[model samples]
Target: MVMQTINKIISANEKINDVLMNQSGLLDVVVYENASYDLNLLQAGQSLKVKVSLLGQNACCTLRTVYLSGTDADNKIEFEVIHAVEQTNSKQEIKGVAAGFGKADFYGVIRMPHGSQKCEGSQSHKALLLSDNACIKCTPELEIYADDVKCAHGSSIGTLDETYLFYLMSRGIDETTARQMLIKAFLLSDMPQAFETEIDKWMEANE
Candidate 1:
């Protein structure tokens, strides 16, 4: 049994070394960008890949909402992932929130190399839209060359749950306050503890 934690800080437009997290090994990756990057992970047995990408534009404040809320239609962020191996099990779940005119595009590809057996993998990408012009696209692809693997992929783009909003309203929160709370929750869902505090502060100043 192997147990370890992998943490790395990468500059923009850099290529990260291939990370292999074996059984019982934990991998955590956080990426913030104005540039591009390539990250690869391999799983011979059971593996976990935890990744977070913060794509922002310093030249424009309008893009901030798109980076966090996933609602700005003019903001464009693209993400891609590829998996290649056999008997390799993996789970990848990505969540994003967009506000204002921000936009996001997610692309995921899972491939089972030839001769791989009993491989199982699942991928899911979800985003929340906070404005009328907010835009998002999710595309998950699977290419299996082996016959004995079980794999699945899913993508969803939508706004906050109205039922949750209604419940908040019933509990005495005003509509705008409820919206703000929900939006915060959505944007912070996958952020790390260290960054969450700073992100909240930034949100306060920007919003």
Candidate 2:
């Protein structure tokens, strides 16, 4: 018999991503075996270090994070994913934005030591800078030592599309509102539908 992974939807527009929305406080780093996980790190609170381990035949997880730093703020994020068992898989997707005079550092790693066979892992990190002094550092690393496994990591940083801003403004949107709309879309576009409203509310309040 072939083993199967069950994914139960929490709501009409929610899936595994909503399972851990409430627990994604950027500090609740814990190992949850044999389950699909989604971690949404909204912003930097002090400095954060995240780590995850995948072991056993049924281990699977997906982690997602986001960060937006205000002016004159400094933030650092470090995370690692280790695959140590066979038939396990994991993925990490990260996004961030830094305002003027702010600095954000994103460092991530994926490791598959010897004997960890038939394991698959993937990671991606992307960030956007909002001003001249906005700074973001993305570093993705991988260490593979086992056979019959697949692992990859990537990082990218960019700025807002001025053409897109112009297009939005041409449609009669004020500059400030247009800017806010673009920022919101960049930060929350891929988030689960179940969380878009609540997170948008929180974002506005925090802004």
Candidate 3:
């Protein structure tokens, strides 16, 4: 069990990306000021835990996860974020697609401790099932111990939308192409542009 720790002071209006791939360990990160942080997780297995802290005014943090599982594969990810100061914001989004007998689980928690006023936090988890025996579970929790703060969380699991698929097919797009496009859109919607090439390679290999 390896532990990675990162501590940094972000200047105003700065943005950074922290990317992890195929790792089974613990990660800790902290950021300050009007900066933005993007935490991306791809193809993780075994178990992973991420702890993030946002400090200073008008800071923002985003956590995005994309996972693909096949038969007998078990993947799990856990994330915790703390808005330790006022006027901070945080978000978590998770997308997964499972096939065969694969199983995936995601647990995310956002905390606004006492005295951390005027903060905003949100989390969303969505998964697609590609086979009858595939399973995915998501749990999002929010703890707001301060006043004048806003928080929300949601989870959803389903297959692709047939109506959207049909609409794409009606426009001269092949079914396979439409499905691939939709899957890519779902998994990469919240990702940064710098990750486009890597995500494209992953999609091509999986396809």
- C-alpha lDDT of all candidate models, in order: 0.49, 0.67, 0.80
Per-residue lDDT of 1-207 in model 3, one digit per residue for the tens?
565554555557789887867667677777788888888878634577778888778889888888776565578888999999999999888888776677898888999999889999989888888668888888788888998999999889999899999999999999878887887788778665555565566446444
lDDT of 1 by residue, 1-207 (tens): 355666655455554444231222444444334333333321112323333332222100001111343222222223222223333344565556555665555555665667656656667666777778766676677877789978887777887899999999999999877877876676556433333554455345434
Lowest summed-lDDT stretch of 10 residues in model 1? 57-66
What lDDT tens digits, residue by residue, belong to model 2 across residues 114-180?
A: 9888889998888888778878888888888897898888888898888999999999998767877
TM-score of each: 0.58, 0.78, 0.81
Predicted model with the maximum lDDT: 3
Q: Which prediction has the highest TM-score against the true structure?
A: 3
Q: Where does candidate 2 clash, by residue pair?
A: none
RMSD of each: 13.7, 8.0, 3.0
lDDT of 1: 0.49
